[model samples]
Target: MNEFVYHPSGKYLFVATGQGRVEIFKMPELELVRTVAAHSGQSNCVALAVSPDGKRVAVGASDALCFIWSIHETICERNLGRLDYHVRAVAFTYDSQLIATGSEDHCIDIAYVNDGSRVHEIRLEGEVYSAAWHPQQLILALHPRVILVNETVSVYDYLATPVESDLRNKNAHIHCCAYMETFRNDSKYPN
Candidate 1:
């Protein structure tokens, strides 16, 4: 993705290098307004999803840690609850109250935004490359092609055990499932 933000007020962009730095500049003029250190290591695998209103920034790393970077504070204030899985994909709920991470570990780490705490650890099968919550429903979408995984999508309540099961195949392997959102879902998936 191009590292820039454009606007009619003026063309602008923020170039974020995975190497813990970000540079912002105007279009054409390329005037630099800010040069800030953004994070550690190559942020390429990093999952950053900004709230729709542009208020909160959710960043997850290979370390199995999810952080809620509060932008209003002008500093990287990480709301914690370091998960034990790899985060493959990160997204915010419609209200941005819940942060859902799909990982390689056959699970999703559904967390509350305010405190960055996990509300439920949703488990699935195979390598969870992509995951997303229904904007209105509590149902979570799992890639049906996850190798050896039953072609069933799991719908989980906020904290209780999953309620739907007619969609699963029998004899699904318990091991070799994805863990954590880093690779696709939450950081804790067993892969």
Candidate 2:
């Protein structure tokens, strides 16, 4: 199983495989949450990003499409159609208002979290290997190679289109992400 992204909440981590399924695992305790059939074929669950607030997740699989799933209630809440380009990395802006995705397409696309509406697309000269939202700043990352990127964990304000951002970027990847609040405050909650 190829675990792509571990959300800040720590309540869930996304595991992708060539098996065509994106599996969610409740963290720390390593509890199994649910497995969503992520793509149409056995495409590698190559890239994934979770919204700020922990209510939604965006995963890339099966071609160049990214699907946004609501984790609040589960059961396939909504589908953000084919993104057209094959994404190599993805991240959410602080406040969760926008999402930044980087691709071999050499473009970074930012979209409204609620409607998948394109906000801005930044062109990268080289293929982006990974990306993330800056935890406290408006700047978004495109495959950040640094080891300790300090950013905010993603959460959501669920509404009309589905979700909204809290505007936090936490420097974390699929395996290292842990809810900042939980670790900082020692909260029992998922954070």
Score residue 149 of candidate 2 by CA lDDT. Answer: 29
Q: Per-prediction count of colliding residue pairs?
A: 40, 30
List runs of model 1 lying over 4 Å from the truth. Answer: 1-17, 20-38, 42-45, 134-139, 142-145, 149-191
Q: Encode model 1's per-residue lDDT on 63-102: one tens digit a residue.
A: 5655666555646665444456555566675566767776
What's the TM-score of every candidate structure?
0.58, 0.67
Q: Candidate 2: global Cα-lDDT?
A: 0.60
Q: Write the per-residue lDDT of candidate 2 for residues 22-50, one digit (tens) a residue.
A: 88888888788787877766576677878
Q: Which model scores highest in TM-score?
A: 2
Position 21, candidate 2: lDDT: 76
lDDT of 1: 0.52
Query: How many backbone clashes can be found in candidate 2?
Result: 30
Residue 171 in model 2: lDDT: 32
